[model samples]
Target: MNIKDYLESGTLEAFVLGSASAAEADELQQLKVKHPEIGYALDAIEADLEMIAQHMAIMPPPGMLERIEDRIHELKRHPVAERLPDQLRDHGQRSEKDKGQYIEVEGASSHMRIHKIWRWIFAAVFILGKIFLGFAIYFYLENRQAREEVKELKREIRQHHTIIGQQ
Candidate 1:
């Protein structure tokens, strides 16, 4: 295929992704042997992807990498079976009490008693958990995206180098 046809078919992107089938790889290999231009195109595509990969890498969330590593180890040690059909419980029931009632979702035992300190403590924990979770997600995404951006920048630099060398 001509350059336009080749690029239009999305084969280059797949090749860059290393997602091309074995048949496609063999064909491309043959093309590379027959034409220097094809090799140059492949190099350019690789350069672009290399840039993307570089840009996507950034510092991961604090303790997240360690936690992930630990989880992997745990998985290896004990393979877990997938459990389906989550536990269903009635939420409509209410215990007759004073003006307000508190119910424990799931625990060994639960009893309602008025206590200002316990309410504040629960609220504080909830808020902190939300903040921690939010930052963890944001950090991971930013780190990954930064790696891709760096890769793109490097690819542009390489392109410039190629052009200047040609000149």
Candidate 2:
């Protein structure tokens, strides 16, 4: 098997991308040990992928993860259960209020109300969220500007180094 042909066969790209099958991965590992060029190619591909990811990375909205987790907890708290039929209910044991068509659910409240203290807490959370969002935007722009400045400085330093080395 020609090394160049194997390199261009997309096997290495699949391996680096983690899309290769188990058999293909085992073969790639064996080839990587026998050939230094395969290892170098893998490293270059991985670096390219990392650079691409860094360029495409975006910050999610604040509290997104918290909201998702809260929703998951709420769902867990209110799990779906099979309703008992009217005939299955013990009407003799029911009170005046419980004698209605509605079945009394145990461990789950029918009336849901947030605590009065939570109203204040929610307002505080909203105000703090806005403040944190503003700070995040400010810092993100500052960091981006700093990165550009560092790149410019590094380029100038490389040019000076090359000029000195030529002389």
How well does each candidate superpose onto the true structure, as a TM-score? 0.36, 0.38
Which regions of candidate 1 fall more than 4 Å away from where they truly are? 1-11, 18-26, 56-58, 80-167
**Residue 103, model 1, lDDT:** 38
Clashing pairs in 2: none
Candidate lDDT (C-alpha), each: 0.72, 0.84
Off by over 4 Å in 2: 60-167
Q: Compared to the true structure, candidate 2 yields what TM-score?
A: 0.38
Report how far off residue 104 is in candidate 2 (Å): 18
For TM-score, the strongest prediction is 2
lDDT of 2 by residue, 56-119 (tens): 9999889889879876776777654434544355544655655656655554546464677999
Query: Alpha-carbon error at 132 in model 2, in Å?
Result: 32
* The 10-residue segment with the lowest total lDDT in model 1: 81-90
